[model samples]
Target: MKKFHRDASTLVLTLISVLLLTVSALICLKALGPHGEPMPSVTDWISAVGQAVGALLTGGALIYAARTYSKQRQDRHEELEQKRQEQAGKIIVRVKHGLPDDRTSVSLTNPTNLPIFKMNLYTIDDDGQVIEGQPLSEEVVVGDYPGHAYTQRYRVHSAYAVFTDSGGVAWIRTSKGTLFE
Candidate 1:
């Protein structure tokens, strides 16, 4: 739809340009002489027309360049925004060691417009044993809101998280790397 509108506008501009050029040429011919009495030279008429249209051509080129630059900037901005949203939606797991107790946190951020549902997290031991973990709540819908988090207080060790979204797609994440759905 937008492309159609842009093409239509370009066609209209081309037609207007042609009309303006024709009118200017006719005016130049009339100025030379109506009955061909003491008519100006052909070179003189051509020079006059070129001088008249020079400023209009310059202005049109400038306008086209400005529009192209604006469009490129807008496209770049939209691409960056998409990347930021993807980065924001990833599952982040962190472990904080304190004097009294070490706490591990599992969080899934939803930067998209759709709300996420039924997210769960799990803990992994040094022996690669999966232990039952907990979430801030069961079946929480998270979106632009603060969302939900699961935290456990234990000695800081190797751990990861697992969850399934409303789409029934499972996701796994660890502190080192390899976090995806």
Candidate 2:
């Protein structure tokens, strides 16, 4: 001990010994960390952080792409629907005329008159039950008319008719079906 204290290398040697003791204590404490210490492993912690960042970026990109695609598809669908409606006659209103002569009834044709859905007319009156009528002049007219296909696409929601030289127009036609039912 006297040689150590008096030696020229005394300070250097003491410092080396102290460093060695500190390193050994650190090793023991680290080795004991797994026994309920919850000390995270370096490799596992690094990988978990990387995966979370990757997942967040990927999810955000997917959501953006889905919304963009949906909006594009909706715009295209609306354009096509409008074009189709232009070629078809859109019904706005219909009025029926009660003729004194049952056979002499005439319909004032509206360019926007929608083609009928079913063959039945909805109203009845005192003079006679308003008979079921179709817009087509005749079965032959339906087959030969260039506009027959255009006529079939739309449906009328409601109408009123009066007996006269001419019948009234159709109202509120839509290619879209009633959503309520």
Candidate 3:
């Protein structure tokens, strides 16, 4: 909307400038002649002024088009970045309750085709403090397919996972479904 307003103002200003120039040229021609008769070389002067105004309008149009294209390209780039960030968030961490005989488990799943590196899953309390689990010593790559699971004996309040995406961007995803870089 702001871009629209700016473009509109620019067009209005250009038109006003052209109108003033044309009126000024007509006034000059009138003042140089007697009894409102067009002076000698009047047609030549008008022709020159017309060419200058045409060039000015053409230049303004080209500049406006270039700026509009640049803005559209930038908007597309930002949209793609946002989509990438959302895809990175698809790395899921969940605490699963198993059968009566089975132990509680924490699983890290990477649904995306891209592999995530240095994945670390943690069980956190209500206060967001890490209550259980340790960071993996080696960088683990979690790919698409069956997820990696850990048998967690302790009851979990919540869970979160930290990992680097295929694009080398780091992200943190909570069990509550919040994701951020």
Top of the candidates by TM-score: 3
lDDT of 1: 0.54
Candidates ranked by TM-score: 3, 1, 2
**Top candidate (lDDT):** 3
Preferred candidate (TM-score higher): 2 or 3: 3
Give TM-scores for every candidate, taking all chains together and pairing residue i with residue i: 0.38, 0.31, 0.66
CA shift at 34, candidate 2, in angstroms?
9.5
Task: Name the lDDT value of residue 31 in candidate 1.
Answer: 57
Error of 1 at 152 (Å): 22
Query: By summed lDDT, which 10 consecutive residues of candidate 2 come out lowest?
Result: 140-149
**Tens digits of lDDT, candidate 3, 1-181:** 7567656766765676667556655665554565756554867677656666765676567556656765786688789788779667677777666735565555677877667877777766546666644543227565532233434444456777788877788898887788988
Model 1 residue 109 distance off true place after TM-score fit, in angstroms = 3.0
User: lDDT of candidate 2?
Assistant: 0.37
User: Of 1 and 2, which scores higher on TM-score?
Assistant: 1
Candidate 1 residue pairs that clash: none
